[model samples]
Each structure stands twice: as C-alpha cells, then as structure tokens.
Target: MDLPRKLLAELLGTALLLAVVIGSGVMAERLSGGNMAVALLANTLATVGGLYVLIELFGPVSGAHFNPAVSAVMAWRGELPRTALPPYVVAQLTGAVLGAWLAHAMFDLPLLQVATRTRSGMGQWIAEGVATFGLLLVILRAPPARVAAMVAAYIGAAYWFTASTSFANPAAVVGRMVSDSFAGIAPASAPGFIVAELIGAAVALLVHPLLSPPRAAGREAASPPSSPARHV
Candidate 1:
C-alpha cells in the first residue's frame, strides 16, 4: 500500500471509530436516564461494532490499527512497516482527540468537563490490562481464516464482562483523556493505563502461542506488513 494513502485511511478509520463511540455514549446517557449499565452496553456494542466494520473497511490499506497499542504490537510482530509507524501513531492519536472533542461538543458538555471525565483507579487499571491483553492475544492468535471475526467478538464480549469496559488501546486511552465524558480518561491517569496495557500485551504475547496453531499458510501471505501470522 502507498504510505500516504494508507496513512490517510488509518486517520479516517480512527476518527470513525471514536466518532461512533462518542455518539453512542451520548445517546446511551440520554436514552437510559443515566443508567450506567444501559449506557455501558450501548457504548460497548456501538464501539465494538463500529470498530469491527471500520477495521475491515480499512484493513486492506492501513491495517486498521485505530489504537496505538495495536500498532505497537504490530510493529513488534513485524506486521507494520517500521518507517510508517510514527505517522500512523500520530494520526491515530490526533483522530482520537478530535473524535473525543467532537463528542464533548455534540453533547453540549464543556471541553474541560470532557478532559476530566476519567474515573480510573487501581481496580480499573487492572481491568484495563486484562482487557487489553485479551484483545491483543486474539489479534495475535486465531485460525487465520477467521481472525477479524474472532477479534471483534472477543473484544465485544470482554467489554461486557470487564469492569474497565476494556479500553484495550493505549492511543484510545490518550484520546479519551481529551474528554471527561463517558469516554474520557483522566490525563493524570492515562499513563498508568497505557503502561498497564503494554504489560498485559507483553504477557499475552509470551503465552498466547502455546494454545494456538503454529501458522496459517495463505493467512501469512496476506497478513499486515507488521502482524506476522505466527499461530504457534
């Protein structure tokens, strides 16, 4: 894929993902009368569904790494092109911030309010790692033929079960910090969340192979430049 073209696609995909998340969160709040469960279910479903489609739509070009952590993992796995990583990461974060800001504005919530919407604590932090690890593990493992489907399902379910609601993506966490709404992470707490995700991903990377297939033949040929198809 052409670097410029892929970069543009990645930017659009990230923006799209964040847009849906913010919109869904706002809608859930309005519809549920502040019911946390309702809001969370709505937000998670929309976010995961949007992500699933967005990634598929842009995967052929940009690898659909709407999250920086995913990009980092891709880099580690040799699936992403090394030189393009910096731009991809920059674009992803920028898109996330913009998306969150738009969500705040759309909901008539103050920018400052959006920036401080984080409720992170020790429990949430641990939840963050577990969710992110699961996400990365599925992306790394799988019966190559069904990787995307498996990833989307695993992510959606994890968001439902995990208390953190599975932020799962470091770039996404930072973007969330720009908003203090249902989607925001406290800027102060963002680093810890990011660190937790990295650690989780590392642990998953080490252990995932033991249970998955060793390789996927045709799958490897079409795999992203950075995501090596090492099942074993």
Candidate 2:
C-alpha cells in the first residue's frame, strides 16, 4: 500500500478499535453497574473482534496494522516497506488520541470517572509483557499460514484467559491511557507497560528467523521454512 493509504488504514483501524471497546465498555458498565470483571470481558472481546474484522477489511490496504508496535514488528519481518514508517506511526498515534477522546465522550457520566484499565505492581507488569509478546507472535503466524478465523479466535481467547488482560499493543496502551475509562491505562504507568511490551517484542524478533521467511537459488532460507506460530 502507498503511504497515504497505509496512514488511513491506521487511522480508521484504531478508531474502529476504540469505538468498539469504548462503546461496548460503556454498554457493559451500564448493564452491569461497573462490574470490573464483566466490563473488562466486554471491552476485551470488543477489541479482539474489532481487530479481526479490521484486519480482513483492510488487510490488502496498508496491511491493517493499527498499532505502531505491530507496524514496527511487520517492518522487522520485511512485511512492510521502509518508506511507510513515518506516515504509519503518525496515523496510528493520531487515531489513538482521537479514539480516547471519543471514549471519554461515551462514558462521560455525571462527574463519573472513565472506564480505564489500571493494573500495576509486579503482576500487572508481568502480565502486560507476556500478553504483548504473545499477541505479536499471534499476528506474525496467523495470516500467511493459519486461517484468519484462528487469528481472531486466539485474540479473543487471550482476553478471556490472560491475567494482564492483554495490554498487548503499545499504541493501544498509549491511546487507552488518554482516557480514564474501563480500557484506559493510568498515564503514569503507560511508560512502564510500553517498555515491558517492547522487551517482549524484542524477544519475538530474536526467534523470528527460525520460524519462517527464506530462500536462495531454489533453496529455502528459514530453517524451518514454516510460518509464524500463534501464541495469543
């Protein structure tokens, strides 16, 4: 995809994600009267569902990488072209900020707080890292080899299972921090979560070569010559 189109993909994808999570989250809160577990389940499901649909909708155009961290990893994988970085990152960040503001609008109660995600301590940090790492692994493996449905299913399942509750995307984390809702991260802790996620992403990069991509003179390059594995 061209730069402009890729940029647009990021913008639209993030907006869709935020709208789904924030909108569904508000609905859940209203329905459950702010039950934390219920609210989280609703929001996480929305996120995973939205990502699945968005990927299919925009897969051809811009690779549908709504998250900058995803874009970073895709670039590393040689999936994204070099020239696409600036526009892609800008688009993703801009969409994220807009998404947060939109979420604020939906859940703006009578001086009520936003429905933000506020996990901390060692458990929270570890969860975020594991979730982020697992998430990236899922992305790399699914499309090329596995079914797209599996891609979506794994994400939803992770939401239901993981302790960190899947703070898997740095872009999502930063954007979510902008609001004070069920899905928002405390701005103060945003940096740490992102750092942990980066570390996880780094680990994914280290093992990437062994999984797939290859060839020279009719010979396969990657050791396994297989696609990425899904860990979400």
Candidate 3:
C-alpha cells in the first residue's frame, strides 16, 4: 500500500480504538451505578467488539496496528518495513491522543484531562508484562484468518484476569493516561506500564520461534503486510 494511505489507516484505526476504549469506560461507569464489576464487564465487552471490528476494517489498510509495541515487533520481525516504523509510531500515537479527546467530546467531558486513577507497583507491572507477552504470542502464532478474533478474545480475558487490566499497548497507555475515568491510567503510572509491556513483547519475540516456527509456505500465503492478517 502507499505510505500515505497506510499512515491514514493507522491514524484512523488507532483513533477509533481509543474512542472505543475510553468511551466505553466512561459509559460503563456512568451506567453501571457504581458497580465496579458491572462497569468492567461492560467495558470489556465493548472493547472486545470494537477491537475486532476495527481490526477487520482497517487490517487490510495498515495491519490495524494501533499499538506501538505491535508495530515495533513487526518491524523487527521483518513483517513491516523498518523505514515505515517511525511514521507508524507517530500515527498511532497521534491517533491514540485524538481518540481520547474524541471520547471526551462524545461524552461531553472536559476536552483534556489528566488521569487520576493510579495503577502502579510490582504486581501491576508484572501483569502488564504478562498481558503483553500473551498478546504478542497470539499475534505471532495464530493463523492469519483467526488473528483478529484471538486478539480481541485475549484482550477481553486479560481485562478481567490481569490486575492492571491489561493496558498492553503503549499507545493505549498513552491514550488512557489522558482520560480520568474508569479506564484511565495515571500519567505517572504510564512509564512503568510501557516498560513492562515492551519487556513482555521482547520476551514473546524471543520465545515465538521456539513455540511456533514460521512456515516457508505460510509466509507466502499470509495476508499482505498492511493487512490485519497477522497483526492486532
């Protein structure tokens, strides 16, 4: 795909992803009547559904990589052109921030706000690492046709299973840090989450070859580089 179109797809996809995440969190919190569990359930369902749809929609254009970690890994793995990595990261980050702002606008909340929900500590950090590791594992291992469902399902489960609620994507961490709501993560906590997620991604990369060696025929059959074929 052309670079401009690819960048636009990444930007729009990431923005929509953030809107789904933050917007759902805000709605769930307001409608759940202070039932944290109920709110979380609602948030998880929305996120999973939105994530799956966005992946299907934009995967054909830019690999539907709304996460910096995913883009970074793909670049390193030779799935993505190294020259495109910087622009992809910039587009994802820009889209993430815009998605946060769009969520606020939709909810009639303040245009910009710093998250106050502090998520930190060793447990949270470890949870982030685990979450990201699993995410990368699924992306690298799943057959191209099944990647979207697997990724969405994994994130949904991670939402409930992980103590840190699986802010596994660095761009997502940045986006969440801007919204002070049920799904927000404090800016102070974002660095740790980012670091932990990167670590997890790195580990996944190292381990993937051992667990699921690439097939010579499969790469040829794989979806185009910009397709949501094997990426999330």
**Candidate number with greatest TM-score:** 3
Please give, for residues 51-164, the per-residue lDDT of candidate 3 as tens digits: 999999998888888999999999987788889999999999999999999999999999889999999999999999999999999998888899899999999999999999
User: Least accurate stretch of 10 residues (summed lDDT) in model 2?
Assistant: 223-232
Question: Model 1, stretches more than 4 Å misplaced?
Answer: 108-114, 212-232
Tens-digit per-residue lDDT, 1-232, candidate 2: 4567667777987777766766776677778775778887777677667777777777666666776777777666556665676677888888877776776676664323443455677777777777766667766555553534665676677676766667677777767776666566777778788888888777776665567645531343333323212211
Candidate 1, 203-226: lDDT as tens digits: 887776565455653465466543
Clashing pairs in 2: 114-180, 114-181, 115-181, 115-182, 116-181, 116-182, 116-184, 215-221
| Clashes (candidate 2) | 8
Candidate 1: residue 43 Cα off by (Å): 1.0
Q: Return the top candidate by lDDT.
A: 3
Q: Arrange candidates, best lDDT first.
A: 3, 1, 2
Q: Assess the local accuracy of residue 147 in candidate 1 as a C-alpha lDDT between 0 and 100.
A: 62
**Clash counts for all predictions:** 10, 8, 2
Order of quality (TM-score): 3, 1, 2
Cand. 2 TM to true fold: 0.82
